[model samples]
Target: MSSRRRLGARWRRHRPLRTRLAVAASAAVALVAVGVCTAAFFVIRYELYHQLDLNLTQSATLVIQQHRGEAPGVLAGECRFQSAPACAQVVPADPAKDPGKGYLLPVSPPVRQVAVGARNGYFTNITLPSGEPARMFTQRIGLQDKSLQVALRSDAVRKGVGQAAGLLSGVGAAGVLLAAALGYWVSRTGLAPVARLTATAEHIAATRDPSHRIELPPGPPDKEDEVTRLAASFNTMLGELEQSVTAQRRLVADASHELRTPLTALRTNAELLARADRLTPAQRDRASAALGRQIREVSVLVNDLIDLARDEEPTPLLEEVRLAPLLAHTVDTARTHWPATPFELDLSDASATLPGVPARLARLISNLLDNAAKFSPAGAPVEVVLLAGELTVRDHGPGIAPADLPHVFDRFYRAEQARALPGSGLGLAMARQIARAHGADLTAHQAPGGGALFRLTLPSEGGPG
Candidate 1:
């Protein structure tokens, strides 16, 4: 089949809601209409035939009564003609003796039984000798060997019933059509809100903007329907989408700004290396070291950006994290890198096991230690203390300015005095992200020793801090 034809067939198999509802309404109305119409037609036919039977029975009785006072065999003559009240038959009566009189219709064997007093009189359908349909009534003349039968033409009765049937059929057809039309109209009226919802969804898809919302009719909540709840849910989803898009745009802009300095330095180092043949031995070595340092800075910034990108999710797969042992190993590694800065640890009651991603917890602790060591003066002590689930890292270096405290954990934020430092600004941001992921909190303030102090408060195994 052609594509369009196949699609049409599929749609027919699963027709729309309105179509099915309309069809159901129409079917119900049709069933009722059919029953009523059939009953009415049969009733009308019965009434028409009943009048014809009464006419035949009455005409026959009146004729028999009129001849009662006469001689026994002297039957009425007018009933023998077609123009009389009814065509009649009188058995055993020869019109030859009563010359110039119209001949009467002959009676059958069943009517002869009435003449012999063998059977009761009854009515029956018959045909006249003139090829006309009729109804006949037969009965015996009292105490005589003769019977009287009367008939009336039935063409008018049949014609009346036919006319009534035609009228009822027309009414039934019109009722069915009207019912189908009304059913469709009612369905359309009820589904108006669904139509509007479909249009709004299509508009959003075409424009790629989630800023628009569905408006609702003003009413009490008790009167509200499922469609109203659906509209509210759709509006909420749009709000979330807009916020996510805004955050993504801001991240991209901030990352570009932070990357500019290192990229420029790398470009300059590349140019210098292109002319390495003209530089002195010491100068070439220094240039090579500078180049490697710039590369390392760029790599660290990229890695930190990746870590912050996963900031929206909580820690995965909660596992027992031995805080004290993880801390000891990380600090030992930090001492190797920052040999000029002495480290002191006071881990008296810090051996508590917490539920978290072990690797993420290690990264959070590392960011804190690295930040403290980088800001401290040469050979100054970076004191690390942990008791229970709280940790404090105090450094004897220039403390953060009060004005910059609130923005310290913001991505790409740098203090005025710290802009000369050789580190990416995402360190504190990544630390805050991981802390939040593990249901903990990290904050920075001035220590009593006139240095920057970073404090981390961790939650219990399954609870928030």
Candidate 2:
């Protein structure tokens, strides 16, 4: 088969609902029309034949009457006349007188030879002189001396019946054509909404634009309708797509901003070290020390960047932590760095229980103490409190601005006072992350005595011992 033919056959086999609906509707109308027309054709033909028989009988009766009244000697042979109701069939007044004329009846031999019954109606099988198959009607007419046979050629009646049937068939075919056209148009109009939806979907696929939308025509809004629900679902999908795209763009922008600072610092320090040989001994020593410091800072920044990039969440591992001992250890380490800065610890009720990772909890406490020691003046005391399940660290240095408190735990974020400090901004952010992993909360606030207060709260049970 040709490609087009094969494709058409495949489509028919698939039989999509719209095409099937149209075909079925059209076929039903055609079948009903044809059936009704066929029945009507048969009924009309039967009635025509009945009326034709009555006409033949009436005409034959008139011809018999004329034969009885006519001048016998003058109209002896080949009698032919047209009168009321038109009489065509004629038989001689005496059949024996014209023996060569055969039976003198319109019907051929066999049926014409048999006399019509008392009922005055009989159909006969016959053959005309033309040798055509025909049916005849022969009826006796008049009374006593007027008695005669009348016959009619059945071929003529059959010809008329055939003509009627042909006409009905043509009319039926025309009706089917009209019905098919009507059905196609009605189906197309009814399915217009579906066509529009298909076109809109194609456009969406081509453009890949989630912002575009379809407008529904005015009607009663029903949630139960499948097409309406599909439109609603598509709109919801577009909303989620927009949110996801926006979030991705924001993340990219934030990552770019955070990477720029470390890169600039690394470049500046490397360029300064390259020019070290031309300087005097004292100047060269200062430059070498500055280069080492910058190198260490760059290394720290790079490590922190890697940590941020590889931030895999750890699974929760609940364990008891001893806060007082952990704080004392952290303070002892802080003293080596800032011995002049007074460290005061109050851990009377520090045995409160909490669920936490021990190493991370210790790191959280150490970061707070380190921040306090670095920011406070030499003689200023850094007060540490462990009460119930709460730990507080306060520094006498300038406190963080109230406006910046909310953003303290955000990655790579720092207040104005903390920007010149030695630590990266990620310290507080990391502390918060560790605290949250163990079902605890961490917050930054202002201490009453003009310093920053960092508060860490854990559950009473499974908290620090």
Candidate 3:
């Protein structure tokens, strides 16, 4: 039994979803139909038998009233021998008083009991002498120990019940057919969106193009269905992927353009070093220094490119970062990098913490400080502060131009005035990327006093309220 059930379950699992749905609908209807038919069959059968019994009871009563004062022998004289569906007979209270058994209905013990008043009157099924089905009613008359009995044919009742069964069978079969059809139609209509989605996915897979989009299924804007949600999510993923690919292409193109000047300078300086004997000692020293500076420039550019690109990729994990010590440490490093420009450090709320990758956050802080220090005049202070879960870095150079404020954090963007400086344009852009990845926002504006101010705002999830 268990093995059979397992096999059935596996078969059902393997069946096509539409077929399973249709079959289930059909099976449910079949069960209901069978139940209704079975109940109706029994009810019709009972009612048919009941009608026949009513008629038999009426006849018996009439017979008892008609022969109320007569002797048992007088009623027995009217008996019909071999009556096809009906006959009458009597049994006296005393067995000897009954007519001979040869020409009368058989006297059962119950019939004898009715004659003697030992049992109440009742109806029962029997067969007449002619071999036809019948119902019998037996009752006692008021006369002493005298009783009346009647029998009626019941073949018509059986025929009526048989007709009802046939009618119900036909109706049940029609209902099952309708149920199966409706199930199939419903499954087909409901799965239409899924079918279209499958086809669209296959097209995307074959073509390797995310430019294609699925049109939204028709529905009210406020009522979002499952398929609609899934399609929307897929479209969103495609948009992000397209943007990432575009950004990568832009990064590569910009990197190549940026590398050209340093590469040419490095090649030219190397050629000069190759002809070392042709030049004097002082000139040779100058060439070597120029070569070293070009090498450092190329190195810094490459590192910045790598950092900017890596920032766009998702960080898989993070740890809680204590902003106080991290800010202090990056500030010290920036002061060393720009020793000529003094830095003013303030850690007001020293215990502020937020969820972030520690190393990335440190790099972000360093980039902001370095950018500020690069723009500050010698001996001018670059003010740094960490208070109330926010960090601000302000420089004391000429404040940012109104036009340059918006593009400061854009990749490879350098204002005309700042083009002569010795730094890649990726520092601020990379800083912003890291800030957003850690659920923080980085924005730049002209400082009220002078120079650029970069503010880093942390999310409230982990930072101090």
Candidate lDDT scores, in order, read 0.79, 0.66, 0.78
Looking at model 3, report the run of 10 residues with the lowest lDDT sum.
Answer: 77-86
Return whichever of 2 and 3 wins on TM-score.
3
Q: How well does each candidate superpose onto the true structure, as a TM-score?
A: 0.59, 0.47, 0.74
Q: What would the per-residue lDDT of candidate 2 be over residues 226-282, giving only the tens digit for each residue?
A: 665666676677778766665455445655675577567657656766776766778
For residues 1-465, write the lDDT of model 3, one tens digit per residue. Answer: 999999999989998776777677767877787788778888988988877777776666666656566655424433232242235655577877865544344567887788778999888877666676667778887657856667776666667878998998887778777777777876677666666677778987998776777777777856977867887787788788778878888889889999998999999989999999999999999999999999988998898888787756356576778899988888888877888989999999898898777887888898888788777889999999888878999998877888888888888988887899877788889888888878788998888867888889888776322
**Residues 360-381, candidate 1, lDDT per residue (tens digit)?**
7888889888989989999899
lDDT of 3: 0.78
Q: Candidate 2: deviation at residue 161, Å? A: 33
- TM-score head-to-head 1 vs 3, winner: 3
Which runs in model 3 stand beyond 4 Å of their true positions? 1-15, 29-43, 50-98, 101-150, 236-325, 350-358, 376-381, 396-425, 436-439, 449-451, 459-465
Which regions of candidate 1 deviate over 4 angstroms?
1-9, 13-197, 218-224, 310-319, 335-344, 373-385, 392-408, 415-418, 436-459, 463-465
Report model 3's TM-score to 2 decimal places.
0.74
Indicate the residue-level lDDT of 106 in model 2. 52
Q: Which residue pairs collide, candidate 2?
A: 351-465, 353-462, 353-463, 354-462, 354-463, 355-462
Q: Worst ten-residue run, lDDT, model 2? A: 72-81
